[model samples]
Target: MYRLLLQNALRPSLQKRRMKDIWVWNGMRMTEVDRIMLGLRQRIKQLDENVVILEKEDDRNLYGAISLRIIELELAEILALLDTLNRTTSNYHHLIIETTAQLQDMMDTMVALVKFDKMQVIKKEHENQQIKKDLEKCKNEQKATLPPPTLSPGHCGLGQMVNVSGPKTYSLTAYGTSYSFGAWGRDVNPAPGNDKYWLVVLSSSNVYGHYVRQYSTLSTLLLGLGPTDTYISSSNPTTNTIQGPNMVMYGNALYYNCYYTLSICRFNMTTRTVSTVALPKDAGYNSKFPFGILGKSYDYTDIDFATDESSLYVIYATTGNFGNVVITKVETSTTPVLGETWYTSLYKATATNTFMVCGVLYATRYIDKETEQIFYSFDTKTNEERYDLKIHIRKMQPNIEYLNYDPRDHLLYVYSDAYIVTYEVMFQ
Candidate 1:
């Protein structure tokens, strides 16, 4: 009887020791799996870095003519290696899952052993009640310390307001002869305050004739211009000489970059007069890259003009200081002239496109076709930069050659290779 009583007294201690041993064994296995995963991740990152270097080489040099064959072979090898690593990682993951299930089963069996003790169960219930009271007290403290929320126009309720309604697809056809303008048309602008949604199309060569076509916003129909409509001028002094992949229409004036000159051209719609304004002395001009010779104008100079709800602004990087951006407001009451000027240290080359929205300067960079474009906004009001906002485009093209934001309708116009897509910008 004494031996039996002693065995019963030591039974709980033996069970605890077995549970501890199982936990230690499971922990060791989990740690090994984690180390393997970490190594695999590091290898993948190295491969990705190599791929980026290869892509840079392809873009900078003529990869098609010289290294195309070699690049193909290298890419194939890398892909195969990645596949092997992925399979190995998957097998390890499965092992981890199985081990985790075994650990859970051990824990459940240990919990079942405790079911025999009624006093232990009552103690656990009391402890759980105390934990609940502690959690409720923490929640109350957090609520009391939280700051009051600020409100803005067009915003209501505790949730964020997002405007996701806009055209998903856009149509782009040859405006004039195919030879007159390259694959993509030159510049496209919407007529200000026009209810009919009149779009102005310019040929690649500014010297060529301007075409005014109307599109029904309701029907998405592209109406060709009639022979009698003469809204687009056939002749202008700055024709062929206008330098731009950028243009903004404000009121009755169309402001454009003047080619071969450090100036911006202003064309009055009602008066039909052209004027030019010289940029700041240090404003950079022309592409600094070899590809700029291929007619990618924005590559050389990085000078751009954008308009917000209340004003027009010119943003450009200074020579020798490519990373510094200078933004100058344009006073268009008379001739186009620079207004309040501000400078930011953001690099201009990082952006594929830049535009102003409600006085804030936003720069966008391509983040692949599947993902949304990345954006960084510089607030002109507070001189602060923000990158926390989430903006998603349903579909993105490989290259967004041009971008324009229309504040009136909160629409973002994108000019990809041969397509002009517009997305509605929902502010949160």
Candidate 2:
């Protein structure tokens, strides 16, 4: 019992020594941690500085590249705009020259009509005073008559699509339902003695095409003869090539939808030159709002080119117009430019095809494999629409891939399932 009491008494001192040792150990441990944290803080500061430098350097490089790209794009746009202006001015100069010639011809025609043929075929004035009087009388008559046209414009033949008959399948294509989509027509306003019939066949994908085959005559196209000229651009889906199957030849220019662009490509076969005209800002392209019904759609055919009595029209839908069909008149004297825009109430996706007759826009829909019905019409002259036209188009195939009216022949040229067909349009 005495030994146990002595051990307990020494235990308090032993416990005090252990507590002191623990306190010293903890102080050493804390000091080491402080030293480690100091090293880590310096390393972290260095890393932060390096990261900031990298970020700033990267920003500088990107900013320089971005600014340069923006400048390049701006310069390119300015160059294109200046080029267009130059072209338009050159066209105006040509117009002035033509106008002067027309004016001289018109004056000569007036002189002939008024019996003032410059002393030829008319009685010569006997007295000098009478000659002056006769000249004065001619001048007075000229002032009294209506002035001649500054430009000798062609007569406008405007009418509605009254009735359509017979799907006479033209023997043109050798594709034979394998291609199944294309566009074919004559020039709406052919220069004298232009018997060229153009055919554009899409690739097997039916999304884009680049080849344009021109037959020398209708017989050549019917006989499936080799083309007089075949223009093949840089492969399929290239920009400025025939993108969609909806196209038309008018005034020696091939107007069609351009690939990778919401615009019209006017390719002049005579000059081998190309021009582009931009569509509306909200115009739909890239298979958006194409001609279709509830479940089926014609792929990559959002743009349709049509011709009337004296004008070329572009049919398209716009997001701003709620996917409704909009027709814009295109002027093709030199570079194609937008003339006038007409909006229709018909939905673009609801129609299977569309065409222009005289000054009216007609929309068609699939009724069956053998017949498609014209269910709507929009008169550009009157800015009116009619849905009761109900003109049925006879078809040799199920789908009409492309349909356009040739004002030159008064025929509807249809490219349906690899075959070309034509129908004569009856007027109202």
Candidate 3:
């Protein structure tokens, strides 16, 4: 018992002594490291400033290659010192304070370098800006020297209502002409299932809503419109009220929606017959609460599909009784049913809607009222909220009439009464 008491009594004193030694060693080492780091940081800041000045010289900057090598060597020494200090530090609390101070110094130095570099670039580009403005002015002056756009007889020919798909090259079903929008980028994939190219036009005639399909080829339409072998018009025009015929060309089959009943139909390119598939059920229409309305009960302003074109999403608004604007998505491969349907109820004073650039579904909610502005982003993935962006215009001077995202260009296309504008958006 005496021996046990003696061991216990000495343990605390021993531990305290060890701890004191550790603290002292850490303190001395930290003091030296701090001094070294502070001096190195000053050197780094000076070198960084020199780097910015040299960078302005462009080709002359390459002459400072030796100076850059020296700066890199100094930066390496600072990093090595930091690693050593980090390993030697006794506890995280003190280490954090010291590291934070060092990081702040580095950050401030970096920010200064960035600012100086940007200023130099701006100074260099100022001449370019002036030249561009002068060139535009000269072009405008030359506009008075030239004639207006000549209108040929069929310059704006109604080639028939066509849908375009694929890369930079767009396939015009009506003309059977695939043209590249830009000079360099172009790709082609024929509409799925149909070997013979066909022009499909959805006609909203007084008597009936029917789809017109005429067969042609890329060469035939581009060379000359050869005779159409088959013309498939809707046989049962009464029941199938097709509206907002945003036709999509999946592999070989063509698909479009009938808005009123909220049904999607697939047409075989060969047989050319319409059959209904399960999709979102259509909403009842009223008009007082919405900004705009489509003419037919089932016709909608916008319909979008996802990136893979595997999912169909549809949007339409009605306002007469202050009913909700509905948004729906249908997974193409899955059987369309109530169990498979996804929807959101957007109560409206006014709402203008559009899909995301990649067609990952989203709705920008906007309501203009007497007192304040309101907006929200409804994400379809989680059936929850993505609170990043909000659209409010009442408090602002200009009101937005339409919002659309261009998946092709990674641009947000906004249309207002006074101006058409584009904003860059990160396309993930």
Between prediction 2 and prediction 3, the one with superior TM-score is 2
Task: State the lDDT at 364 in candidate 2.
Answer: 91
Clashing residue pairs in candidate 2, if any?
none
> Can you rank all candidates by TM-score, best first?
2, 1, 3
Candidate 1, superposed: residue stretches over 4 Å from native: 1-169, 174-202, 205-240, 288-301, 387-390
Candidate 1 lDDT, 165-277, residue by residue in tens: 34465666435323221112112234445444434334544322243344435244333433122243454423524444556666656666665567777766556677878
Ranking by lDDT: 2, 1, 3
lDDT of 2 by residue, 1-428 (tens): 32244336445543543453354356433444344334434543443444344445546466656544544454344345434434544454576679999999999999787775656443554566688996896465434322321211223543333467565555548667678888988887878887688888887488777767788888778777878654646677665777778899988888888887888998888777789989988999889979986689998889998987778889999988899999998988788889899888898999999987767788999988877888777778677777765567767878899999887678899998888889887653
Give the root-mean-square deviation of each candidate in angstroms: 32.8, 40.1, 31.6
User: Candidate 1 lDDT (Cα, whole model)?
Assistant: 0.55
Candidate 3 off by > 4 Å: 1-202, 205-209, 212-241, 259-262, 277-282, 285-310, 316-322, 325-327, 333-339, 345-353, 356-359, 363-377, 384-428
TM-score of each: 0.52, 0.62, 0.35
What residue pairs are clashing in model 1?
Answer: 207-240, 243-259, 286-300, 286-301, 287-300, 288-300
Error of 3 at 97 (Å): 99
Reference-based lDDT, each prediction: 0.55, 0.73, 0.41
lDDT of 3 by residue, 314-364 (tens): 454333323554455544432332223344455433334444322234444
